[model samples]
Each structure stands twice: as structure tokens, then as C-alpha cells.
Target: MSSLRETVPWQEEPDDGTDGPVVPSRDGAAEDIRLFDGAMDPAREEGLLAGLELLGADAARGAQLDFELLRGWQQHVLHTPQPSAFRNLPAFAKKGRERYGIAPDTRARLDACLAESSTAGGRSLPLAARAARACLDVCFFHPFEDGNARSAFLTLLFVLAREGVALNDVGLLRRITFQATDPQDALILARYFDAHLAETRRGAACPGS
Candidate 1:
């Protein structure tokens, strides 16, 4: 089976010259917590909140992305006393429209891709692109045994928060279903990030309604 990770158009997404606001005024992740809570069972809601708390702390400390870091969060996302482990077999998604094939080096590849989410060494990917790619990476990599969608969402949030950016709203981001093989999906995700970032900046400039 063809891997979704191999087809993502990471290099094709354009960087709009700016990376939105350097600081965000509101907690968009908190908003997501509420939104997720309304849609999920109580245990899942608690897990989401706990995962978000871990994301906030990791972002504050400038922690880089990695399997270990993700596992730390996935424990909360899965509502498990222990961190979730990487999947030992292939994973399917989109009602079987996509298949993420497994390999001996799959976890290593995932780790390498996660590391790219960092802006270190003067990496030029815009904040929006980095976050979008990180989300896609998690979605397609299908790293954990369960809760990969929630994990992807948290990864995106961490990418933005690490750089002092957060959205006041993320409905466009969280509600969409992206295809791994479509290059347009990658660009569209980046555009969504751009939209949210712009709106967050505007809200920050205004302070109060």
C-alpha cells in the first residue's frame, strides 16, 4: 500500500511573507477543549483537557517534537495511566480510503518528520506551514494505537504555541477532513492556519469588543 506520508506536498505550500502575530491574546486550545467536551464522553473530555495542559507546558519550555513527547501527551489523550505505544501494524483511515503502511523504520521516519516542526537552524517554513505539516504528519503517520486525530490536533497547537501564536477560533482547522495524497489538502491546511492566525492577530489588536 502507498503511504500517505510519502505523498504530502510539504515543499509546495507557499509562505505568505509573514507568520501572523508574535503573541496571541486568547486561548484557542481552551476553546477547543470546550468544543471537544460537548462532542465526546466525559472521560474523553477529561483526557483532552489533560493533554492540552501538557501541550501548554511543553510549548512554554520550547520542547521539540518527538515520539517520546507525543507519547507523554497520548497517555492523557487515551485516558491511560501509561503513555500510549506506537502501532505495531498498519493503520487505516478515511473509511479505508487511506492506508498508512508500516515499516521497520516507520517510527524513525515519524520522529524525523516531527523534528522538522521545529524552527531551529533558521528553518524557513512559516509558522502556519510548520503547524499544518505537523498535523498532517500525525494524521498520516498514524503513530499511536488510538486517538491519532486528537494527537494531530494537539501537535498543531503546540507548533503554533511554541512560537507565541494561538487562534481564538479553530473550527475551520479541527472540523475539516484532509486527504493525504492530495497536494491541495496540504496548501488548504496552511491557508486555514493563515486565516486563523490573521484573525487572532486582529483580535489581539482590538483588545476588547
Candidate 2:
């Protein structure tokens, strides 16, 4: 498995609805998708790279992962049951789109933000704050036909990991997810992630004998 830096390309431009720099054909795509199906196999190592790559691309504004694309990747890798991929953006615009529907405009807004965040420029804040804002924006936008929350969470992890931030506390993230009621709640969660990142960084400092 390649390092996240090595496997994923960092793009400064927005994805223009193309297949991305690393397009997956039927055969190649299947192999890439299979890498992250939640199965306990050596492939997971490779799958993690693939998953990071996808999220990174999304973050970089390299491409959009519609519901179908997300489900296809999930099925190929994890073989999990998911909603139909035929859903379009208008279907996602209704109230509670998080449950069913996605607004096309909102999807574009979120994608643009993801792309901006992926690149290395922005206001300096606690790492967790940035992650929280990014993740919350996606969750609030609920852009995809499905898996908006999952995508937001995964994208947050991928961005932080790329920044060399340690995030070994899945429990904390899960707890925050359950607690978040709105965008503000997500921001609060980001504070926690920032604190965790700071502590981890301190712990990694070399010990002086």
C-alpha cells in the first residue's frame, strides 16, 4: 500500500464532472472498490489507501461521488446493502434530504468546499476545528443521494490523516456523531478533535533522557 501522499494526487482545481485523474474501468474499478468493503483481509490495507484517495480527491475537488458511485464502491468493496444509485440531485433537495433527497446546488457547494479544504491553504485554526467545519458542512448539506454523513466522516478522517494527525479514537467520533444536532454541534465536535490532535502531537515528541 502506498502512503496517502504517494497514492493520491493533490488538486487545486475543482472536479469538472470528469472521471478524475485516476479513473477506474470495469476491471480496474472493481479491484479498487473491493479494497474497502469492510472485509477482514489483506486487501484492507490497499482498500484504506483507495478510500483515502477517494476522499482526498473529493476534498481536493477532483470529483463528485454521487449516491450510485458511493454505493457501487461500497458494494464492490464491502458487499453491503445500500440504497439505489439512480437518484438524482433534485431528489435530494427536499426537506430532510438527509433521509431522502439531495439538492444539486447544495452538492456543488459542498464539493467546492471539500476541494478547497483538501489543498494546503486557509485560515489557521485548531486542526480539529477545520475538520469539524468541513465535516459539518457536508453533513448539513447532505449532498449525496445517500451516505452524506458517512462521506463527511470519512472525508474528515482522510484530511486529518493526510495532515499527519493521529486519530485513533473512533469511539469519540462515534459519540460526537450521536450528539451532534446541527452545524453548531458539529463545530463543537471539531473542538474535541482539535484537542485530541494536539495531545497526540505532544505525545509524539521525542523523549529526552
Candidate 3:
């Protein structure tokens, strides 16, 4: 089978034009949901919460996307002393059905793709598309040895947070696995982001009703 890292439909994903140029919305929806997630799994959610905190801090300072930045988040995610480093050898997922082979320049390629996650790279793509793409990047890249799913989730949240778009409900995102090679999956994820954005905006409009 071909490497998922290469087969993933990263470039073909389209932006959901429903919401244009997102403005900052300081809704602590992520925190609330993460708290709920914590109740189910403390150790796992603690790292998620920690990573979220780091994401907020990094967003506040207008930090750029880089491997080290991800490592910082991954360190907390896996409860490791140092930042988690990129895997040097091939990685597999989906019970050995999907393989992510590493090449000599794989790290560099991953870095370049991540850099596009920044707001400056794809100006035309709306917040949802960019955020979804970044999430998928982590998924397909399989950067770390473990906890890549969590890392991908955090990346999605960070992208939305930086753009001031936090979802009131991430139920659609949770427990849903995406395919790397399917363009439809990309569109579906972007639509999920749109749905959450719509709900969050509606809630903001009527806070106590």
C-alpha cells in the first residue's frame, strides 16, 4: 500500500465559504468540553487541557507554526519530560492497514506543510478549512510515536482559537475517524467546523435565552 503521508488529500480540500474572515470570539467552549472529557479520563484529559492552555498562550503571542511548537504541546500530551520528537522510522495506523513511511526528507516536508497552517499561507481559505487541514496534517504525518490523535485534535483547536472560533460542541469531531486519501472526508470535516461555528455564533447572540 502507498504511504498515507503521501496519499492524503491535503491540497484538494476546499474552504467552506459560509463564514468569512473569522473574528476573535473569546468563548471558553473548549475548556468546558475538555473538562467533561477529563471526567472520563483524567490523565489523558489533563494533557489535553495542558495542551489547550499552551495553545491559548501561543495564540496570544501570535506564534508561528513549527515542529518545536508541536513538540511543546506533545510533551504535555504524553506526560513526557521533554518534547516529543518526530518518529524516525515508518509508522502504522488502523491496525496495520494504513502505513506512514518515513523518508530522508520527510521531516522537512512535514514542516513545510505545517507552515501552511499559519494564517499567512492560505489567505483565501476560511478559518474552518485551514483548521481542518492542519488537523489532518497531524493525522497523516503521524509525527509522534504515540498520541497523534490527541495532537491532531489540539492542532485543530489551536487553529480555531487563533482565529477566534471555538466550537460550543465538538461532538461531531469526537470519536470520528477520517480517511487520509478521501477528499470527501476533508469536505465533511470542514462542514463539521462550520456547523459548530454556527451554533457558537447563535449561542453568543442569545446568551441567557
Candidate 4:
């Protein structure tokens, strides 16, 4: 199986039990990546980039994970008048050369996971471990009709924020996509989090970093 990072222009189809050809919306992953990298100062950009600013504002409030909060973050990343809601049926993703199957009850499952993970019992897990779990949970659940990648990324930010963690070197995190089912990928993400966290605390920069 090809790794997600090796994929080229992975495509998302209209697979929510709908009856229409997948229209090439202007808001697909490629377009989202362009906005994230090019117009990072959400305050100075419009569309998705501008919405990214709104995402930050909401994050500033605090890191409280729940279905409503996740939906709210989706609202910011997607400013569509009536942004595409949670999948009423099922959703799928093509990562690299492999395809992922999503659960029909993904909505409810995600709600339960978030609810449980927010409590004291959940805090027992290591910080990076918790972050990686949240990250993959969003990835495999495939919550939204679109922008699942962006949503998953934001979920990591929220999970870290709750623990008062921030990383100045997010280059590793932002630029790569991980396989949904690979256990090793989870450990690697934890390492990435630790490395970035260490760099942030030591106040060191790696040339372009």
C-alpha cells in the first residue's frame, strides 16, 4: 500500500449517498493548501485564509472539545453561507494510492470520543499521545463533507492548547499527511510534537525555522 505522503493530488468524490457528479468546488484540498501557505495572515486574507483568522479567535477562547466546538471550528474554516454539514450518511477519503472507508455512525462515535477524552480520566494519557489520538480520530472519522484535513489539524491545535502546549516549528506538522491506520505514524507524530515543543522552549531556530 502506498503511503498517504506519497500520494499525488488525491481526489475526493461525491460519496454521501448523493446523486450527483462530484463537482470541482473551488474549496478542495489543493485550494486549501494554497491558502494556508500563501495567505497565512488570516487577518490580511479573505475566503478560507480570512476564515482561518476567525478560527484563531475562537481558539483564543479556550480548548474545550465537543461536537459543537468542532462544528464551530468548521464554520470558521468554511464560511459558506450554509457550509456543508456533517455527513448524513458516510464519507470516504483517497490518501495516496489507498482509500479509507468511514463508518456510517461516525458522527455519534466522534461525539462520544470527544466527550470522554475531555474529562480527567482522559488527561492521564501522555500529552503527545493525546494530541496524536485526537488528530487521527478526526482523520479516520471524516466528519465534514469537505475540509477534513483542515479540521483534523485544528483538532490537534485545540488538544495542545488545552494542555498549554504550543509549537513555533510547525513545519513538520503542517506539511505532511499521515496514514489513518498506521500505528507507527502515531508515534512519529508524537515525536514531531516533542521536537517542535522542545525547539519552542529552547528558543532555537533551524535556519529557515
Pick the TM-score winner. Answer: 1
- Give the TM-score of each candidate: 0.91, 0.51, 0.85, 0.67
Q: What is the lDDT of residue 5 in candidate 1?
A: 50
Candidates sorted on lDDT, descending: 1, 3, 4, 2
Q: What is the lDDT of residue 182 in candidate 1?
A: 84
lDDT of 3 by residue, 79-111 (tens): 999888889999999998788888878777777
Candidate 1 structure quality by residue, lDDT tens digits, 1-209:
12545566667767766664456576777777776764777778788888888998999998979888999999998878888888999999878888888898889989888888887879658777788888888988899878998999999988887877778888888889988778678779988888887877788788885
**Which is the better candidate, 1 or 4, if ranked by TM-score?**
1
Candidate 2, residues 20-134: lDDT per residue as tens digits?
A: 1221112222233344333446554454445555555544553443333344443323324653343355433334433433454554555555554444465444455556656
Q: Candidate 4 regions off by >4 Å?
A: 1-36, 39-63, 95-104, 116-119, 204-209
Candidate 2 global CA lDDT score: 0.45
**Residue 180's C-alpha lDDT in candidate 1?**
78
Off by over 4 Å in 3: 1-36
lDDT of each: 0.82, 0.45, 0.74, 0.57
By TM-score, rank the candidates, best first. Answer: 1, 3, 4, 2
- Measured with C-alpha atoms, the lDDT of residue 51 in candidate 1 is 88
Number of clashes in model 2?
Answer: 12
Between prediction 1 and prediction 4, the one with superior lDDT is 1
lDDT of 4 at 12: 22
lDDT of 4 by residue, 31-95 (tens): 44455645665532344454444445555675467656777767756666664577765556673
